[model samples]
Target: MEPTPTKETVELTTESGTLRRRGEWVVPRLLRIRSQAGAVRLDMSQARIAHPVVDIELSVLSGSIVLVLPDGATADLDRLHSPHASHRSRVPAVPTHQAPHFVLSGETYTGALRVRYARGHRRR
Candidate 1:
């Protein structure tokens, strides 16, 4: 069977801020940007993606932030490195698994991303 095409979108809300969804393959990568006080914060936490990508790229003009990822999330190349610092670094890649199942706002932060789609565990 042919694979489904990827769908990308960014969600914005006054309470949480901006969320960017890119690639719904096996692993779903969610990006979020919010104004904390007067500073913009970038967070990629609890990103329960079906497919673990080899690399991800992010840049900023002026700001300080942290990325929250699950314990097993691997950026590969430099296991102990800031692999998420950019997409062009040395990192082992992860296969994309499935389309985003459970809908949770990263900025909204419902729970562990790994459990976001735990409801559909019986599908396959």
Candidate 2:
């Protein structure tokens, strides 16, 4: 039998669209990427937020820039190309999407995700 969920799922809390982690970030309960179009971007021109439960790295970067996610959240990273990553060093493939590198199992917490982009590389 399936165990009943004891915690609240952010599946209902998250709304579609690109959401910029506002001034004082609030750690939500469940951070879920339910759809394909739905995205979350962490701009560099922001401060350290209160931390996020789960980070949904958006596939939308018209230009090259590094983004930082909230602290402690399960970061879904989308890699970018840059001088170092593109010219200086060699990267196998431009990653389209990335999940937190660890074991995940019905756990809850807060954290950040970091993403870096190269020049002229748009989110595919």
Candidate 3:
């Protein structure tokens, strides 16, 4: 008697173009991204996010949102402002009691918000 696997909640909305999350997707516990001008990319670095607390909410006006993880991935950000546009994270924010916590709230007006962490060694 063994059966346990149920976790999925991924909401995505776009009003202009591009919303992509590739491969064996599995990173949802409330990942909502809304855009008006277009462009939201989430490449889970091969895929596998079984949730531990991942709540990512984003609302963009001009367009552009990219999040790619896989390198001991860990994220916790809730401070993004875009008037002319430009917000970046190269992986450096992990302290919310830690346990696979990716909580990111967002609002970009002019566009461009990126969080990328995928470097070296990946060949099983």
Question: Compared with the true structure, what per-residue lDDT tens digits does model 2 show for residues 1-124?
Answer: 6433333333422234544444433333434332222344533223322322333322222222124432222333233222222111112222222422211122111222235433444444
When sorted by TM-score, best at the front, the candidate numbers are: 1, 3, 2
Ranked by TM-score, the better of candidates 2 and 3 is 3
Superposition error at 28 for model 1 (Å) = 3.8
lDDT of 1: 0.29
Q: Candidate 3: worst 10 consecutive residues by lDDT?
A: 1-10
CA RMSD for every model? 11.1, 13.3, 12.4
Where does model 2 exceed 4 Å of error?
A: 1-8, 12-16, 42-67, 70-124
Return the TM-score for candidate 1, rounded to 2 decimals.
0.31
lDDT of all predictions: 0.29, 0.31, 0.75
Highest TM-score scorer: 1
Ranking 1 against 2 by lDDT, winner: 2
Q: For candidate 3, report its TM-score.
A: 0.30
TM-score per candidate, in order? Answer: 0.31, 0.28, 0.30
Among all windows of ten consecutive residues in candidate 1, which has the lowest summed lDDT?
Answer: 108-117
Clash list (residue pairs), candidate 3: none
